[model samples]
Target: MRLHAASLYYFDAVRRAGSIRAAARRLNVASSAVNRQILKLEDEIGAVLFERVPGGVRLTAAGEALARHVVVVLQDFERARGEIEGLKGARIGHVDIVTIEGLTRTFLPEALGQLHDRAPRITVSATTQGSDRIAAMVTGGQADMGIGFDIQRQPDLRQAAVARFRLGLVAAPGHPLAGRPWVTLNDCIGHRLILPDASLSIHRILRPLLADLPPGEGAFVTSSSVQLMYRMTLAGLGISFQTRLGLEPELARGELVHVPLMRQGEPMWSELGIYVRAGRSLAPSVDLTLRLMADHLVAVAREG
Candidate 1:
């Protein structure tokens, strides 16, 4: 009747990562080994923990119930481990953070600089991904905290506004549109555009503004490569649309220009929020990071 820690770790990893393969990569283990441990854990608990769903794994009803307890158990175990490590004069701990792409470009570097300065011994690993992925990571327990835009308020999650920003039309300096005081949505339709892919939050925000245009068209769609977009825009591929923060360095360097839109007063405004699981107690390192996050966001808001 003894439960093994390895089995618990496997169950938690699969639940967090949403797939066995992802869990294996995160844990540095063979996928089959992770699966075997999960099977053993299910047998020990006498309950199924995941359902094989199309696209990815899902939690069954029982799995959902077990997931709550498992998260608490694992979090407490991690806290205990951290406390023990701290007793040895080491503040070793981990905080899994998911963030939107804009912050990854500008916000995260400065924010993490603050965190690192305060807790030099604490390790903070961040995952730079799309908003949808951040939502899933925060809800599914893959991330201890998330910095994102337009986060959903779910019964399983708690959030606080960290910052706010709006989208802007960006193009390489000296590009044809650069001198324009304002560019219209129609102005972009036929032109080469290096905008965010349809799946990104910024793109989603701009969809309605560009809806009159036919499908399978945009100028160009891109996912996570901001530098590539900068280069592409400079190369005359198309005008890129992104948060102003993302274009700051290029804008300052005269490599990119942020142009306001004529059709709208400003592009869609989005709130950057910090989120954590609803009922979880955060570890010291995570709590400190959250505090630093709040301060940083305030600073960003002031500059905004």
Candidate 2:
């Protein structure tokens, strides 16, 4: 059955808001107009798309199936428009990215600076989120790409590139363990530790290592913010366990030192991945940003 763009857009809004009136408010249109388009779509498809409830409507199996196609169709249309603009010698387009909080402080800013130098017309909209939410943003079409550590495999997302970053102990220059090439969890437990909380991916990577330490010798301070953790480390409050990816500035300025977290005298590593929605073609601006980020991440990984 043929469907209009208006119908698909109205349907998508209803699915997201779960209430026709709510969707209408968001779309700045009348509720009856939104309902009429959805009804037309259902008639063309010959099936009830939503299960009307007292508070809101829920997508039926048919609606769920159609929603997936609608996302792809709308995204493809946007990509096509961007490509057409590129063909007309205009490099103007927007690239949206969702990344881990750490990158915003270090790698992302550098990468975006380079991107702007290369393509001044391209605009970037970036959001910092936890690693777990990065993949979901890409899959949902909210962001063109996601960058994070320890991202699990998702059916609707693909890993475009990856870097394995070594987890390490970071401290101020005068700290006792700062001179060490590597340190074990037991050795780290002897001092105050400023550690990432369960919300951060680094926390999960260090969980096994922490489990190996004496039961009561956990982190002295646990936080989800990378910047706060880094600041605490620089202030000589405690050593933090983290990757070198976002610590380049501090390391270069002699503000912080990174010693590899050792297990049997070898460094522990976590995988950092660049992700995009599976089976979707990227727009020109997104493709360029992905390449730039991949290059920077691979270089950082190699150095780590």
RMSD of each: 3.8, 3.7
Q: Give the alpha carbon lDDT tens digit for every residue of 103-140 in model 1.
A: 77778989888877877888877888777677777766
lDDT of 2 by residue, 1-304 (tens): 2244698999988986889999999999999999999999999999999999999999999998998888788777767777888899877688889998888877899889889988899999899988877877788776889999998897989999998878888999999999987888888767998988877888888887778777678888998888888888889999998888778888999999999887886778888899999999888878888899899888777776
Off by over 4 Å in 2: 1-4, 10-64, 302-304
Assess each prediction's global lDDT (C-alpha) against the native: 0.76, 0.86
Candidate 2 backbone clash number? 0
TM-score of each: 0.81, 0.83
Q: Give the Cα-based TM-score of candidate 1 against the true structure.
A: 0.81
Model 2 lDDT at residue 123: 95
Q: Which runs of model 1 end up more than 4 angstroms from their true locations?
A: 1-5, 16-36, 50-61, 80-90, 214-217, 222-227, 262-268
The number of the candidate with the highest lDDT is: 2
